[model samples]
Target: MTSSGTHTVDAVVVGAGHNGLVAANLLADAGWEVVVLEATGAPGGAVRSAEVTAPGYLSDLYSSFYPLGYASPVLRGLDLARYGLSWRHAPDVLAHLMPDGQAAVINRDPEVTAASLEAFAPGDGDRWLHAYADWQQVAEPMMTAITTPFPPVRGGLSLLRRLRTAGALRLARRLVVPVRKLGDELFDGAGGPTLLAGCALHTDLAPEEAGSGVYGWLLAMLGQQIGWPVPVGGAQQITDALVARLTARGGRISYHARVDRVLTARGRAMGARTVDGSLWRARRAVLADVPAPALYLDLVGAAVLPPRLVEDLAHFRWDGSTLKVDWALSAPVPWTNRAVATAGTVHLGADLDGLTGYAAALARSELPRDPFLLVGQMTTADPEHSPPGTESLWAYTHLPFRRDWRADEIAEHVTRMEQVLEDAAPGFRQLVVGRHVAGPADLERENPSLVGGALGGGTAAAYQQLFLRPIPGLGRADTPVDRLYLASASAHPGGGVHGAPGANAARAALARDRALTGAAYARLISTANRALYP
Candidate 1:
């Protein structure tokens, strides 16, 4: 229901992104009166899909694949398939193409993947299988630890119980190991090492950075298990399913309602005011599905935040800016190596040394001359993405955030990116019936939470991860202010389409409002906040 001046609800959620919708659904499921406010006319933040390139060719505006979405326990528990969500996958999950034309392909069947790896090195197939077997032992508990709230009591205990069996300590060390080192330790050939290094580049992490292996190993393992699926029609279907589920549960989302400020009283978040001058008063809580800086600095106002938090925000780092190009192709990408055509997602880079150089350039605040590309074969993954006999494709690469992405700059980057694609796929440019480019500025204009096009909310570097995320405290959703939760990718378990941050926020709010423990919970959280932020 639309309201004029003052609207009251049990909870007010800022942003209608996937995380916000997830938070709203969970709150509504508990019978709380919840309302979500979104700045854009559409609901999805980065998950939207449209025919940006050409008619009848749907392209995901931002994220495309679904390995994390498929493996996420929070998203899985929602049973979104009941609300019109269906997944489709290509025959092969991913193929990483090197400049030398050698490719490492991951197949759904482990034996097939192993065989492909074996072709690169004699004993690597068995080595891959051994690693997979080890992952199998701790997969459940480890995923739980990752997707659940911080401290992860249950998941942590479960890991402890399986310590000896799962090689828990060794696995923990591997989680922090650099992808470059991890690849060398695990495989003797370029194929295996290239595959791991390429997957690690999916994030802002460089191959040599600590904790890069965690992302690389996790994503590679997920591709093996789930095949990096996509929604049947487009990425929008995932958003539609979440919205369907949310509205069905009696939650309402107000579109074009941009929250300008969080209304507070006595240091507690009580509501939020939109740019339209409408006040949404929440009697229970307010959850913000925005980047940390946006919530703490712009919306809440720096004066209202603790001086320490305001100072800490100065040190907050964003992931690299992005440059994306979408193409509506009249025919499939004619990859030089036929094997590359089989996969839904492809990683284009030279090798480990090239990846390191690319990272070095970004660190120096210069765009890489040869950028590493993460490409998606939309039509290959799901035929509905485009007209029959044609393909909907997109590729994105990271750039240093310091660069100015003007129109001319965007054009130059697009040409460079296409050149990289053309090298892997001969005549790649000839098949383009239509083309669209989105640089960092365009992305930020579309979704403010994607500051500088940093998709992961913030850097996933070890210094800013886990308990230290978005500035240290208890890594839970509770913020310095009472009755407010950070329900975005900026929170714990940093980025991905998993919706764990939102789930964690909702769960914290629910626990704080519980009948018997309500007061105690609030007091405990407040006490922790004081100590951390003081």
Candidate 2:
């Protein structure tokens, strides 16, 4: 992929996902020459799109929602709108359906959302509103803390300053509390708790696991401020915008150029070598948007890693595997309730207990007879996603890794999911004109980073979180290798389309470069500041 043989750049980024693109764009903005290498023919790894079902129906292959994208300050800096990237949102964010044919809907207005919650219990509405008000105080701080360095000392100190001692402790406990328990402790009805647990499914974490409630609460609040918006055309627009920015700044991105090994000399990263014997020589650094195990075990070689880190990789637990089905229907889903059809995202689990049961099934490595589904009606968010009166939608659920999928097994899974929806919305399958099923195997074939279909980087368990993501004492984007960094979801803050990991890696690389450039520059700046100010 070297247009010029033996090419050189200030930095070489491996994997052209959103994270890698972010680092590449930022480096180029600083006037540093950068090159991005992608394994696939096109960019936007998981954040990709295709017309899988019908001719005119546009289906998002992996991700469909972008609440984090809308709320991200890092992405806000980009003029994505100028690059033909517009966002579309549903009038209502989501709904959690119940077995009793009742549903709790999340509306844009806090007052309206809270009032709706009162349908479950007389006083639940006020509690939901008040709890959300409390959540706002720490939402920014929590985002800051997780997205920053390992200890997140500065973000933590700022949060402490705002929450004080008692307030801080309470908030910490609230975030760590399991979603299933949180709802029971805080509300008297199934609506509020079901809503929170539905959010927990965004990750692989079970509703009963600690830190699961944080996602439910965090996503709900963000949905209030910003609906789960989607790119106007498709998720591909995001990749297009990032690639446009990178190329406009004189950076290069090479596709189908798979990196074979990270070239290191004298315990320092020099660059990388592709499988085709193409060597990309980096002058300043190399940043990788890959999983920890892949980076350490495959690319860098296990011989170079510390013994403890090698051991940590052994115990690394992946999130539950996923089974996704996309459909191009002749008409919108005939939700018997009629209300659930209005939301962009819909939780298809029967009730709160149904969600917890799905989680329980995962913990036991068994397929749930009643799988919890996260269904998306793209046309609900943007009519342009499909033809007039038709729908391009998808439904995703989790399966334990033990049940390795075969072609027949995948077909069975798809049928089960359709039946589940049909139970709630009769004649649902009658509307399907075309269908595409992505089992765990198909997902891995589409994106290797998904590795056995584990989404959300890795398991967001209590032990594997904070300073222990990927491995213990290795949460920072900077790796032990000099001039090398982990800029992927496997690093701190884990997965999501947020691009925080990439931003952190870019900042880390710049800081390391300044330090490596020599202490003379550092001392000169210190002395100059003193002379000018003091």
The candidate that wins on TM-score is: 1
Per-residue lDDT over 1-534 for candidate 2, one digit per residue giving the tens place of the 0 to 100 score: 444357788999999989899888888888889999888888888889899998999999998899887777667777678777899888889988888888899988888788779999999999988887886777777777766767788779988999999998987897799988888887998899989889888888888888998888888878876778999988998989999988899999888888989999876789988888888899988999988888989999988766767877899888888999999999999998987889999998668778878888878988788878999999989888899999999999988863367787778778789988999999998999998988888887778788888777788887787778777764677676677888888888888888888888888778767756634533543354344323
Which sections of candidate 2 miss by over 4 Å?
A: 1-5, 515-534
RMSD values for the candidates in order, in angstroms, are: 1.2, 4.9
Clash list (residue pairs), candidate 1: none
Best by lDDT: 1
Kindly list the per-residue Cα lDDT of model 1 for residues 45-120, writing each as its tens digit.
Answer: 9998999999999999999998888888999999999999999999899998888888889999999889888988
In model 2, the worst 10-residue window by lDDT is: 525-534
Q: After superposition, how far is residue 384 of candidate 2 from its true place, in Å?
A: 1.4
For candidate 2, the lDDT comes to 0.84
- TM-score, candidate 1, is 0.98
